[model samples]
Target: MCIVKKFYVADSHFGHERIIEMCARPFSSVDEMDETLIANWNAVVGDDDIVYHLGDFAMNLADEDRVRAIFNWLRGRKFLILGNHDYKRVNQLHPTLARLEWMATPTTSLETTDGGHRVYLSHYAHRTWPGQHKGAFHFYGHSHGNCPPIGRSRDVGVDLPDVAFRPRTFDELTKGMIE
Candidate 1:
């Protein structure tokens, strides 16, 4: 298994100009979009931090080598939870699996040491899982227009609120969930 860290960011959704324009908001051009993402990323993330790009990394890539190189330039470790837009050709360019760390699959589960559960990193929120309403948080991203549902339950982890989109600090993520 990879060396997991206490904090991570979900869904950078880099390199897709159309989706970035539509979903990220206020990005007049792709360059502006890249700048916004990079700035937000650098602000919250430190060199030792780990980030989880939970899908839709690149739709049309001219080169994967350049992509991995960019990841390196970003200055932190990355773990990708591949989304629908990721193609096999893009996977071939990376050194490891389709995603940087995690396998490129439709749905997977990640467990915190204390046993809280979260699901659906890269895709959109279609409909909330009825049974999961009282169980673990089900995180998805297909419906870019909607926000991930955060239901209340006794069993739910404490940090569930901050787990959604928008920038969050590493300390905020770990403090709420870990101890």
Candidate 2:
């Protein structure tokens, strides 16, 4: 039997030129940043993989077409956990919005099994989540590696050093958190 793979990523902030300076991203330009992000995403995520994107996907609300184009370039069956910046922009970008498997608000729970482990998904880190005491792993974004890990919860945002600004497999994410 084949086991499907699941991945997690967050805070890509695609098309946001100011983010390069704000986040101290290595890219010299927004175009370069966007290209690198797309390349990194495609490198780790396969076509069959399911990726949970924990918000702030893009900042360019003015150009819906460009945002849609960027989404088209990515690989995976993506589920969006809406972040602060995703509101008006993502809704306007119909092409990208239509392609998502599902979309939820910043604070939502997703109960799923990965690598024989139960996990929860959300956009913002939580002190206590559903099944926290029961050993259910929690994955979240929005803190962008600034927030400390709480209990079994981890920041799945791409801003972390371990993730290298790309989507990471479920096993990879859990392993990093465990270490």
Candidate 3:
């Protein structure tokens, strides 16, 4: 049996041009950024893989259809972990985006299928989460690399060079977690 992989990334901020300058992203244009992000995503994320987007998916695009189309281009079963940029309620999202059937509820906490370790997912960095003290890992975004890990926690935002503008598997995010 083949095992489906799960990946994580945050604050892609897809259509936001200023983000490139703000985050010092290497791309030369917003189109380049968007294309590269999508390419990088599809390169690693198989059709059967799972992707957890920590939020700030796309912004500055007034067209809901374009926004939905952008999302539709990516391969995988995607989940959202609502960030400040994503609006407070799912109903408030653009009609098209809101209409898409996400794989699960935005709120999430789970056990790693690979390690059996508890994991919490969010868009904002939390000083403490449900299992923080007990060795559970917390992954979040929004600071764009400003916030350091409190312990087994860190920013999974796409702007971070280490993440390379693509979703990361649990193992990739936790490789150094053992030390």
| Candidate with the greatest TM-score versus the true structure | 3
Poorest stretch of ten by lDDT in candidate 2:
100-109
Steric clashes per prediction: 7, 0, 0
Assess candidate 3 and give its lDDT. Answer: 0.82
- What does the lDDT read for residue 174 in candidate 3? 86
Tens digit per residue, CA lDDT, model 1, 78-97 = 55544555545544433323
TM-score of each: 0.59, 0.86, 0.90
TM-score quality measure for candidate 1: 0.59
RMSD to truth, every model: 6.7, 3.2, 2.2
Sort by TM-score, best first: what order?
3, 2, 1
What stretches of model 2 exceed 4 Å from their correct place?
1-3, 89-109, 176-179
Please state the error at residue 123 of candidate 3 in Å: 0.3
Quantify all predictions' global Cα lDDT against the true fold.
0.46, 0.79, 0.82
